[model samples]
Target chain A: MSDTKPLVDVRDLKEYFPIHTGWGRTLPLKAVDGVSFTIKPGETLGLVGESGCGKTTVGRTLLHLYKPTGGEFYFDGELVTEKNMPSLRKQMQMVFQDPYSSLNPRMTVEDIIGEPLDVHHLYSGRAERREKILSLMETVGLNAEHATRYAHEFSGGQRQRIGIARALAVNPRFIVCDEPVSALDVSIQAQVVNMFEDLREKLGVAYLFIAHDLLIVHHISDRIAVMYLGRIVEIADANELNNNPIHPYSISLLSAVPIPDPRIARSKQRIIPEGEIPSPLHKPSGCAFRTRCPYATERCAAECPELTERSDGHLVACFNK
Target chain B: MSDTTPKKAPFSMQIDPALFEPATAEEKKQQEVMSESTTFLKDSMKKLMRNPLAVFSIVVLAFILIVIIVAPLVVPYGYSEILKYNGMKDKTAMNLAPFQYSANEQKYMAENGVTLFPHIFGTDELSRDYFIRVVYGTRVSLAVGFFASLIVLVIGVLYGSISGYCGGRVDLIMMRIVDVIYSLPDMLVIILLSVVLKELLDGSKGIIARLGTNMVSIFIVFGMLYWVGMARLVRGQILSVKENEYVLAAKSIGTSSPRIIRRHILPNCLSVIIITTALQIPSAIFTESFLSFIGLGVAAPMPSLGSLANAARQGMQSYPYKLMFPALMICLIVLALNLLGDGLRDALDPKLRK
Candidate 1:
């Protein structure tokens, strides 16, 4: 995978929100603090974390929806900046988590999908625009008859499909699938996930799939990165991380994934952590998981751990691992 | 197992591959039980049609519009022209009763072999036909209401969309300016502007001279002060609508800021804008009438409903019907507009829809 250049390379991305702490003072809530990852062409990199761990923020910042406080984003070896964001946006797109809110309620399905085409002037004329929209809708498994209908008329799964069609309108090289199936039914999630996989195979598009569903992430990802608090603690191949997690947080997380067989489920050792996840507003010093870690040492609190290669293609950030 | 006795076949766990085949076009078409497609506007219009009160209001407004338009053509009397017979001022026509002809008009008709039009709502103190004046008054008031609201709509939508979409420091400063405008006394501004504009536009002819300084000042005041309400409303709406994931989706797709507001945010805010504009018309009409009542509306000889009512105030005891005519017209217009506005609010507001 390293032979081909990475389609998206994010380095030391930091996004801080200044929240008013009252009394004429403010504090920087470190939502995403120096998180970094890279996606090779046509690869799916799954980002898993608890709620409010900046999973969505990472996706948004990469797309320049919310300007990153500090970071360097290289897309196809070209540095993405404010000056070039409009042009670079053509190569990247995003599928939001919520199906209902992600589509403009006022717009018809045809208009929704054609918006990107209109913005980029991608089509030759009206007929070509219509043809492009219909083809895109068909690609996402939407009916041609459903084009003129408003967003409110569609079901949740169909709405998500329309959103997907809209994302695919520009033929983007990379997409940020931010919990795309999180707001869907279990039955529908499978269909959408399968469609995503099919599109990746057919179109050769890369994805930054952010979701907390470990099973879904494991099922679709080529590589998986485990995040704790605002930092990534472990990253490795999906099967390798699932079978042999190095970080304690990832260990606890994988242990929580339910097994189908009752025999294994009854015999499995559940490593429930000792404390609640610390608030990002006042993150703990040093290793964020140390307070909940079983093997917390004095050095763990004294210094923050850096991601180190434990084996081929496996990275862990911990002192006593 | 091979004996003649009924041998049970071994159970097979394998499923048929044919059942797993993709659905045919015929079957897929049957599965797609979708309703007829309708745009947002057409859907809203359907909902609006179902409302009987709104329908009735619409009919009444339509009837009133037709009456105002047609009455001028049929009445055969200019709004400001005094009643004259055989090219002479008919002094006896002053304060005549409804449908009555003056002694000179009767004599002149008898002599010239031509019958004259009677005063439909009686002649005013100035001997002008009151019905034509009333019709012209309705025209002036409706024009003011519509133009003023249009001015408010353009300025408010532009200002508010920019302020809300830009947000942060720009929004803060822009909103503070809106706050300052909101705090200013609207009535005082109208009076001051009218005083100044009357002098400045004194000799101007054509439409300006016809609208007069007072009407122009009222429109200016509406553009300046009245738009704050709409601006604040649109700002509040955009502030919330901008946070929706669709807006972020548009941004991620490289949609320009103006296009995002125009195609996405503004369309979502349409209900509020339509409702506010509908409601604004009545208020503007009322304000213009009130200003006219105080001798600050359209210039002299240009009859407005308020000025007509003011003229009728003196003859209240003797000719009570004079007051009734203009008063009833004003009431009907304002009430019809108010009802229409309410109906629009209920129809256009998606939150209020079933």
Candidate 2:
């Protein structure tokens, strides 16, 4: 990692959604609980987890899109409070997960991408605004001719690029990319991922790349953070975490990834966890993963294991690890 | 040779099939939305042009409007003018058939060596030109329909946007008010109000007197009752459309609520608004005709279509054609508006787009 101060430093963010059953009674759905991470000026942090593990919520919270139910977000060493959200939005933007639904159908490509510029007043005149919008589109590899087109006229990959261009319009330092390429065809995924990498290098923007696909995350992330039911199970350097995942949950997750070599792939064991994930409403008393953990013991049930550093800059949440 | 010289590159390098080359300039014209800028409305308008029934309806409505507006200016007789010359009633002209002239007119024309003009649709029992009366009746019905629908549109859009976008307590309170209004006996109230308003506006001055008491009362009833349907539709549309991801995206971009509601939410709900408003015109026209049938519409001599039909009913056995002209005009207008409404719904719907 670089020695420079982190561009985005988030500590112990908690987002609890209230579910109203009836008549003044409500239940708390802990979407993100005590999550902590930091991204340097140009670093990419990959967030990987299963569906409904609150991966998207983390990205949303960092950008202050959702009013963080509880957390401290420091963007470039300044605290991100509600009062500053309007101004801070210029420095931080987001690329949504579903490219199909994200862009407004009624708006033209020029207007979609120009909205950020319109919001920030980045340019002096109409010509300058058009120039900036066209340049942003070019950065995302879109043709200038695509400006007048509507969202439905474009393919899924092209639509994603329009979204990326919109995000880049504000010239943000960090962007929270929530599965920006997941909605594309598998063949088109690689092309989009390559463009993302190219744009990252060209623009020097950091990202919290959230996705459920481990392989896609592994390709572009500088560091990897594994989340299980809204809590970080393990976090480490990209190569270190892949080669040596400390948490039992991480080990099981990493093992699920298919190996190309036939001999080695045959030798690997598939550790599929038994039973469905326990509901967040009725989570296990201590050690939320213990319900499906093969090595569950009375000790795990007695105490909730906090994330502890096992080695230099490598953190794991299991007591055994 | 391999050691001494540089190795030749693969043949595929010069003709890379897998390279990320964009399409050539020649093929750019084939791209969708490439020719010129077009909005959802403009695109929908183009689609509307393609629908034969809708186009026919538009032409029909335009023709009716032009005739109603222009016919009175060129036609010599007033709709209510009792046939007379100088201070004497031309009694012989009463109940004359189309193309038939009075004896005096024919004799005067023979003396002057010129053709005497005939009443195109003949004369009524009161010896007034039937064609001009029918035209004036159409004008009255069209005006009432348009004004009523305009009132509904203005009130409904404002009320619905506030109710749906504000949400929570405000929405609940506003919606309950709508429910209360919806459940009320609307027609009865309209009838009562019409009676009361006519009494109040009777023989009034300026625009009120010009519109006549019944027309003014019809407008009031429209303002009170017709807006609820439009409001509910707009509210429902705003509720769903405001929840879309694009709305959230707009919010995340730091857009204010009012601007978002105007630029994003309202434009998205435009299809629903337009369809409802178009349908409202026929509905208001029907309501006016119904009220007029019961002797509650525009006062006599103003000659609304319903009044004309009512006037013709007394002598239906003698002059059946008198009732047919106004009745046919109403039928044609209502059918045209209904087709146009259906066409607007199909054209403007975002989901139906390719």
Per-candidate TM-score, chain A: 0.98, 0.97
Model 1 spans with C-alpha error above 4 angstroms: B1-31, B38-50, B85-92, B103-115, B205-207, B342-354
lDDT tens digits by residue: candidate 1, A1-321: 768899999998999999998997999989889898899999999999889989999999999888899989999999999999999888999999999999987788999999999999999999999999999989999889999987887778999999999999999999999999999999999999999999999999999999999999999999999988778999999999999998989999999999866668999999999989888888889998888899999999899999999998899999888
- Residue B7 CA displacement from its true place in model 1, Å: 23
State which candidate has the highest DockQ: 1
Query: What is the per-residue lDDT of model 2 for residues B99-149, given as tens digits with 9 covering 90 to 100?
Result: 788776776678889975579888888888888999999999999999999
Report how far residue B124 has shifted in candidate 2, in Å: 3.1
lDDT of 2 at B291: 87
CAPRI quality of model 2 = medium
Give the runs in model 2 whose Cα sits over 4 Å from its true position. A1-3, A22-24, A261-263, B1-45, B85-116, B199-213, B345-354
